[model samples]
Target: MAYKITSQCISCKLCLSVCPTGAIKVVDGNHWIDSELCTNCDGSIHTVPQCKAGCPTADGCVKQPSDYWEGWFANYNRVLAKLTNKQDYWENWRNTYSQKFSEKLQKHQGQVPA
Candidate 1:
């Protein structure tokens, strides 16, 4: 089975940078994993799917049952193509990511040793 990116994604693009197979896609703010290109990182290079590990949001990347994943791409694309508000969707995601990043940075900065 392959992984899929859910609505919880914050558009950080970490998954894209870490994906070895280049299976994860972000087109017009719609993110999805191409099962055809996704190997789930089964090989020795990584113990976990990089996309999942790199994703900051809990449950951002999820596994799909093999049967359900078979035709997921076509249907997903069909639905996303109908949406016309991609710019707003992308901006919202970017804002969310920036806010979370700022919060985490502040928390970590507080722990700096003197």
Candidate 2:
């Protein structure tokens, strides 16, 4: 399976330059991996996935099926809060975003469009 960029990405764009297939793209304020083009760095220039290696965040790039987007976002926010000394700000944002996400999930009955 291809690797996916989590919400932990931070939109640093470091992965873009490292990706051999040009699969990573910035969309809607986040950096996303194009699954079709992603090769998990297999049979490419790198032995390890470049995105994962290039990413500064813990678990920023991970195997798709195993990476839960919501959890990743929460973890990312937590780490960001600590790093930036903005715990309160990040916590507030996380709470608001989580609430909105939950509401949307409920409205969709847990079926999110891929």
Q: Total clashing residue pairs per candidate? A: 0, 0
- Distance from true location, Cα of 64 in model 1, Å: 1.1
lDDT of each: 0.82, 0.84
TM-score of each: 0.56, 0.56
Which lDDT value does model 2 have at 80?
76
**Residue-wise C-alpha lDDT for candidate 1, range 1-114, written one tens digit per residue:** 788988788888889878889898889987889999999988739998899887888667877656765558755764686454365877888899999999999999999986
- Candidate 1 stretches greater than 4 Å from native: 67-114
Counting only residues 3 or more apart in sequence or on different chains, how many pairs clash (N, Cα, C under 3 Å) in candidate 2? 0
TM-score of candidate 2 against the unseen true structure: 0.56
As a whole number from 0 to 100, the lDDT of residue 108 in candidate 2 is 97
lDDT value, candidate 2, whole model:
0.84
Model 2: ten consecutive residues of lowest lDDT:
62-71
Compose the digit string of candidate 2's lDDT tens values, residues 1-114: 788887667888899999999999987878888999998999986889999988899777876764588658866876776768864786898999999999998989867776
Report the Cα lDDT for residue 103, model 1: 100
Model 1 root-mean-square deviation = 18.5
